[model samples]
Target: MPAYGLRSHAWPVTHAVTELIAVNAALTPGRELYLSLRHRDSALRIVVWDQHPRHADPDTRALCEARRSTALWLLAAVVDDWGGEWGSGEARPPQQGVKSWVLLPQ
Candidate 1:
């Protein structure tokens, strides 16, 4: 990622990726996870995929709040943009998983 001029964003992006993997590993053992970093145009994108799409129910404010109170918040703070999606049809080949991504200016 640093090779793409992301040296300044690498640490925080790596931390966010690590936390996402750790959280998924701890909460959903035996499931597969994937991490991807891409540099396009003038931006760097970091994405983490885990096989737990419905891990948190956004309909429940309390649960959402609890889930948001983690490294994800810090990730959002450090990146230019960040978001997540629950579905198997995005991020990679068709599969059941959740995709969390952060984008930083290059």
Candidate 2:
């Protein structure tokens, strides 16, 4: 984040990634977790993918309202925007996974 002139966002970004990893690990023990960071002209994107094919999608309104995890709540508050989707087996040929991403404006 600092590399992209987003020094102020570094801590929040790190916390978001750590929280995502922890949540994935707790929910799907032993499953693989993947993290990706991308810098765009206007935003920085942080994504975490986990090998939990059948887990609930993070996009549902009900899940957002019912979420009891303080880490997730904090993550949502810190990031400018966030969302997730379940990767299709055909699209993610190597493994079916759930992808969660946070976007912070640059």
Candidate 3:
């Protein structure tokens, strides 16, 4: 396994690399961030979770929004060009955060 736990054969989208950069730019400083990259069903899955203030909380949603970087706009272009799907949602139970993910067909 590679340092990031991805298989040796796994590779990122050469032209859609902005996804990772945008996710990192949106993260909360000093907070925990988890990343997972894997190949499944002939596609590449990339997920990034951040321990930022949950968007479901109205008061903190603004805080989280304020932390978002304009760089995230690049994700749209990348996804469109690659025919990939990307979205974000609340983390699952036991995890209070957000997860942004993208799926790109191989």
The model with the greater lDDT, 1 or 3, is 3
Residue by residue across 1-106, what tens digits does model 1's lDDT show? 6566667766766766776677656645798887787778776666667775453544664463356345355555655243322212224557456566666666
Q: Which segments of candidate 3 are over 4 A away from where they belong?
A: 1-18, 55-71
Per lDDT, what order, best first? 3, 2, 1
**Each candidate's TM vs. the true structure?**
0.64, 0.68, 0.67
Poorly placed runs, candidate 1 (over 4 Å):
53-71, 80-93
Predictions: Cα RMSD each: 5.0, 5.8, 5.1
| Collision count for each candidate, in order | 0, 0, 0
Ranking by TM-score: 2, 3, 1
Best by lDDT: 3
For candidate 3, lDDT tens digit of each residue in 67-88?
Answer: 4534456765777667778777
On TM-score, the leading prediction is 2
> Of 2 and 3, which scores higher on lDDT?
3
